[model samples]
Target: MQTTLRRPVALSGIGLHTGRPARVTISPAAAELGIWFHRTDVKAADPYIAARWDGVEQVPLCTRLVNEDGVSVSTVEHLMAALAGCGVHNAMIEVTGPEIPILDGSAAAFAQAILGAGVRRLDTPVRALRVCRPVEVAGPGGALARIEPAEGLSIAFEIDFADAAIGRQRLSLDMGNGAFVRELCDSRTFCRAADIDRMRAAGLALGGTLDNAVVVEGDRVLSPGGLRHSDEPVRHKMLDALGDLALAGAPLLGAYTGRRAGHALTNGLLRALFATPGAVEWVECDAECQRRLPGMGVRLADLAAVA
Candidate 1:
């Protein structure tokens, strides 16, 4: 069955790139509404922004959604992942600023809050986008992303960094059995310390600090709390992929593979998936298929493993 938040859940924090403070609330919506963002600050014009792949702005360093009216919401990947991971199919995310908060640099907090608020199953059944054939996209720096047929949502990601602290890491997981909540939710976004000044000079990462991101300097990790996992950088890449894929506007029953891919490449993959003929088909998921999809068997207790 499709689901929505049982009640409203709220959070407040600073935007990762914009550095602006905002309060966001995820409230229940009618079945089939999908996920959307409403800018509470923009009251005069249309403030609604669809949280779909076509709405993506293809920006670097974050996932952004812009409506036809030019009102945009930035850095929405984590919150989107939380909603999709927790099995909330329909929601209205109301934010008081141009970007959603980058709380903890991971979806653990969002997952915890959503689970605490509970999920209400709707009368309608879930409709998932099943990949019929493989579709791939290439990005600058040799990044590649592709999705192919699979029984459930499976993710395999590989990342390589010149920094010794994050040389190379890879992970593959079947996103079932509460795997998202337990394994990937706590992995935080990371960056190289040498690029911090350059990024800041280029007007990015203004709100970034040691607390929210894992900073690596060659062989050293500069973050205060260290890492939540050994291969945290790669895990976070997978987490970001999940969030980006959520913009498909439905659960994807397929295997996603990302090779050194970021938000742009993932969005490109989605664009390719939809544009190619015979690449995907929407089907009303059966009971067994629904059970195998991400979030189906998730429980609030699974958050205990986030950290």
Candidate 2:
């Protein structure tokens, strides 16, 4: 069966790119309602932006969705990942500003809130996108994003950076059984010190500070508290991928492999998956398949106590 949050939950913070304060609320919706964002400040026109892949507007720093009326919301990946991982099928996310809060720079807060609010099943069932064939997209380097037919959500990501603290890292996981909360939830978003400066000069990162993003300079980490994990950067990338995949508008039954891939490459893979005929199909999951889905038998106590 599909699920929705037991009640509305709110998170307030500043946007990573805009640096503006915003309040975002995740509220329960009826089954099949999908996910949407309403710009609460824009009361004159239609402000609803669909949370589907087709609505995505590519921005270098984050996942953004735009509506027909030109209203948009940025930095939605962390929140989306929380919804997918927590098995939330329907919601209406409302934001008062242009970006979602960069709270602790990870999805942990969002997941913990949803679990505390809890989920209740609706009478309807969930529909998932089933991979029918292998599809892939490659970037300038050997970087690639590929997906193949699989029984449930699985991801394998590998990253290599020149910085000694984050030179090479790899992680693979079968997303079932609350693995997301245990492994990827605490990993924070990271960037090189030079990149931050460049972004700042280009009118970006206005809302970024040492607290919301991990800054790496050569072999040293500039973030005050340091990393939550040894290979925090790569784990965060995998977490981002899960959020990007959630935009498919439904759960995906497949194996995702990302090599030095980021938001663009992952979105490209989704475009390719949908455009290529016979590449994917919508399937109604049976009890056996449902059992294998992520967080199938997860309990609320599984979330880590991090504050």
Candidate 3:
């Protein structure tokens, strides 16, 4: 069955890159509406933007969606992941600024709030994109993202950083049965201390602070409290990938593997998947198939594992 939030949920914080304060409200939409963003601040141009692969505009450091009218929203990965991982099939997201607030640098808050507000099952059956063949995309520095056939959504990610604090780390998960909420939602975005100055010089990460993100200098973690997980950086990467994959416009039944891949590479993989003939097919999910999807069995109790 399709699902939507039972009631509206609202959040407010500062954008990680724009550094502007914004408020976002997630409201339920009719079945098949999918996810959409309405920029309340835009008065002259079109305020609506569909959250889909073709709408994506490749940009450094974040996932952004631009509509035909050039209206855009940035850094939407976490919130998107929360909605997808919570089995939300349709929603209307209203934002007061260009970028989604980087709340605690993780999707935990969003997931918790959604679960608390409750998910209502719709009359329509759910549809999912099933990968029929492997589709891969490669980027500079040997980065790669691929999706292949799988019984359910799964992710395997590997990341290597020269910083001793976040060297090489890899993890693979089935992603079903509340795994995202329990294992990945609380993992915060991380960065190397040395790169912070460069990002600031480029006018990015302006709202970043030790409180919202994990900052590492050499072997030390500069954040007030330590990491939620030892391999938090890699886990956060997987979280981002899940959010990016949600842009496929439906739940995906496939295995995703990322090798040092970032936002652009993931979005490229989606484009490749759809553009390649016989790479994917949409099918109405059966009862058994729906049970294997991410967030199918998620409940409010799942919040106990999140932080």
lDDT of 2 by residue, 224-272 (tens): 9788899889899999999999999999999999999999899999999
Candidate 2 structure, TM-score to reference: 0.97
Where does candidate 2 stray beyond 4 Å? 305-307
TM-score-better candidate, 2 vs 3: 3
lDDT of candidate 3 over 180-216, digit per residue (tens):
9999999999999999999999999999999899999
Write down the TM-score of every candidate: 0.98, 0.97, 0.99
Local distance difference test values of all predictions, in order: 0.91, 0.89, 0.95
lDDT of 1 at 197: 90
lDDT of 1 by residue, 38-127 (tens): 999998789999999999997779999999998999999988888888888999999999888888899999999999999999999999
User: If both were scored by lDDT, which would come out higher, candidate 1 or candidate 3?
Assistant: 3
Error of 2 at 295 (Å): 2.6
lDDT of 2: 0.89
Off by over 4 Å in 1: none
Residue pairs in clash, model 1: none
Where does model 3 exceed 4 Å of error?
none
